[model samples]
Target: MGLLVFGGACLQGVGGLGFSMFCAPIALLLFPELVPGPLLALGCPLALLAGLREFKAIEWGTAGYTLVGRALGAALATAVLQVLSGPTLSVVFALLILGGVALSVQGWVVRVTPAASSAAGVASGLMGTITSAGAPPLAIALQDLQPAPLRATLGCVFFIGSVMSLLALAAAGKTDAHNLLIGVLLLPWMAAGFFASGPLARRMSRTGVRRVLLTLATFSALAVLAQGLLHSQA
Candidate 1:
């Protein structure tokens, strides 16, 4: 688990949003208790570190809009979860993410307007709360930004979203002392990976970042899809 956290943190440090993407699927299969709640808790500090690393580059206006949307989406997800199965929601959102990635590849550039950001945030919140894989929507929406701003803005948005998610999980009785302790114990690994990513982040070009971002987004969607399918089968 420490190794997993370390690796995921390094990926997030370089691309601003991949810790859960990289960790959730494996953890779900092995350390099931470590996911959603504990992973979301760990994400908060990791995102904070990334945001502070490029504080000046954060888009405050976009972040604000995204947060509001995230709150609404989370609320909606909470209500929806009572009605729908998690695997069903996961499959739906995973398809949506893949569609977004496809459009992006086809030259559909999403401008960082208030509506787009907020909408992406809503999707992010819903998917994140259910699947612990929320970054894909927002990452796709902001993929056009320069690397620094992209990383910083995503970091900020994710930080707040993560906190909101933790609260939601706590209210839903998904969080507990054991999971919180797991998150706390993994902090050192997260920190180590974050610091280690500095040199690699500095060396990555804009194109490289975009490629990595898109790839990660696609991987996130696929992983969610697989998870949903497996759960449905079971």
Candidate 2:
């Protein structure tokens, strides 16, 4: 679990996304207790560190607009949780993630206007709240932005969204003390990953980082698809 958390956090620190996306499905398989709550708890500090590393580059205008859509989307997802079974939601979410990744890889470009930001945020919030795979929408939406700004803005958006998701999970009675404890324990590993990212991120070109990020997203989505398949079989 520590190694997984460290690897995922390293990806998050370098690409500004992938911590939970990369780690959550595996955690669900290995340590079911470290999910939704504990994993989300780990997100707060990890995102903050990643964002702060490139703090000067954050695009506040875009992030602000996205927040509004994220809130609405999260509410809608909560409603979905109430109506859908776990297997159903997992399958649906995994499909959406795969679709999002396909669109990104195809170079589908949506201009980073306020409207686009909001749309991405809504999608991200819905996905993140349910599947812990929120970054793809925002990542696709901001694919054209410079790496520093993109990473910083994404980190901020994720940091805030993580808080909101945790609160919602708590209200839904999905989070508990055990999850929190596990999340807290994982913090050290997360920190280690973040610290290790500095040299690596600095060495990689922006294009390289972007390619790596998209590849990671693709594989993460596949992982989710596998999880959904297992759930359906069960």
Candidate 3:
């Protein structure tokens, strides 16, 4: 778990994506307690770190527009959580991950207008609140931006979204000391991975990094979907 968290965090530090999307599926298999709650808790600090690191590159205008959408999406997600069963939620998350991957690979040139930004934000908020895997939507939305701005703006967006998810989780009684302790325990690993990312970030092209993320995201989503199927069968 620590190693996975470290790797995911390192990737996020370098590419501004993949921390939760990579970690959450594996964590669901290995440590079921650390899914949306602990991951969201951990992501708050990790995202803030990235946002601060590239603060100058952030597209604040887009961030504001997306945040407004996130507010709406998070509210809807909170409502969804009230009635959905665990396996159902897992399946929903899996589909969302797969859908995001499909959109990314399709080469659709979506203009980042305010309307699109808010729509993407709403999607991200819903997915992030449910699965802790919101980056794909935002990543696709900002794909046309410069790599530095893309990464920085994403980090800032995630920072705020994570806070909202954590608060919602806490209100739903899904967050507790156990989840928080797990998040705290993984901090050092996350920090180590983050530092290691500096070299990798310099070496890899943005396209190459995004390709890797797409592959990992697809695999993670498939894995979770399989897990959900098995759980439902059981």
Candidate 4:
């Protein structure tokens, strides 16, 4: 349990770039039973806290569409994950994030506009559903914005999505007694991460943050591939 808590905090802290790419997969792998249930439940707080810490920086105008996109994306993910094998879904999602990271690092991040919001939202909904991977499209959509607003909007979208997701996952019977127990056990770690959000944001510039996120995405890709390989061998 201690290990799970630490794993959650550390993975999220380094390079998830205000996203849940690494944290969600790690949570599912380490505690499969709690995934999309307690794990998702707990993760929302981390995103919420991170976003709020940079509230002043949030690009309030475009944030709403991102939230709407996230809600739709969460719905789509819930549907897809219901039908897909866990390993397959994880690997696919990992690849998606890896691609986004690669594109960004290669200077391919397209400047986002309101017109891109709907399309990005659709993609965001689909990917985020399977992997809690809610950052890719939003990153593109918010690319033109400054770091403060960018991260802030991400925080808001994630928080909103987390709320919607919790409800959706709960309605689907993903949440249960065991899930609650895991959440309780992980409260301290979640609290600690939330507490540290301010300091974490101050530690990096936007480009630095994006680079870190891309790095994490690469690591996530390898991790997913490894899992697939291990599962195949098994």
What do the candidate models score in CA lDDT, each in turn? 0.89, 0.80, 0.79, 0.64
Q: TM-score winner among the candidates? A: 1
User: Candidate 2 — number of clashing residue pairs?
Assistant: 0
Ranking by lDDT: 1, 2, 3, 4
What's the CA error at residue 80 for candidate 3, in Å?
A: 5.9
Which tens-of-lDDT digit does each residue in 1-234 have in candidate 2? 899989988988788788887888788779887877888899888988878999999999998989888888877888888988656676676676668667766876567999999988888777766666777777667777777888898888888888777787899999888788888888899899989988888887777776767777677767766766787798
**TM-scores of the models, in the order given:** 0.92, 0.87, 0.83, 0.77
For 43-161, candidate 4 gives per-residue lDDT tens digits of 67776665766778776656676666656766677677679865687677667656766677678876666656656776778766654555655654455555677666666766777
Error (Å) of candidate 2 at residue 229 is 3.7
In terms of TM-score, which candidate is stronger, 1 or 2? 1
Model 2 scores worst on lDDT over the 10 consecutive residues at 85-94
Cα deviation of 115, candidate 2, in Å: 1.7
* lDDT by residue for model 1 (16-123), tens: 888988898889889988878888899999999999999999999989998888878877899999999999999999998899888888888788899999998898
Better model by TM-score: candidate 1 vs candidate 4:
1
- Candidate 3: stretches off by over 4 Å: 78-106, 227-234
Q: Point out where model 1 deviates above 4 Å.
A: 79-84
Any idea how many clashes model 1 has? 0
Q: Score residue 215 of candidate 2 by CA lDDT.
A: 78
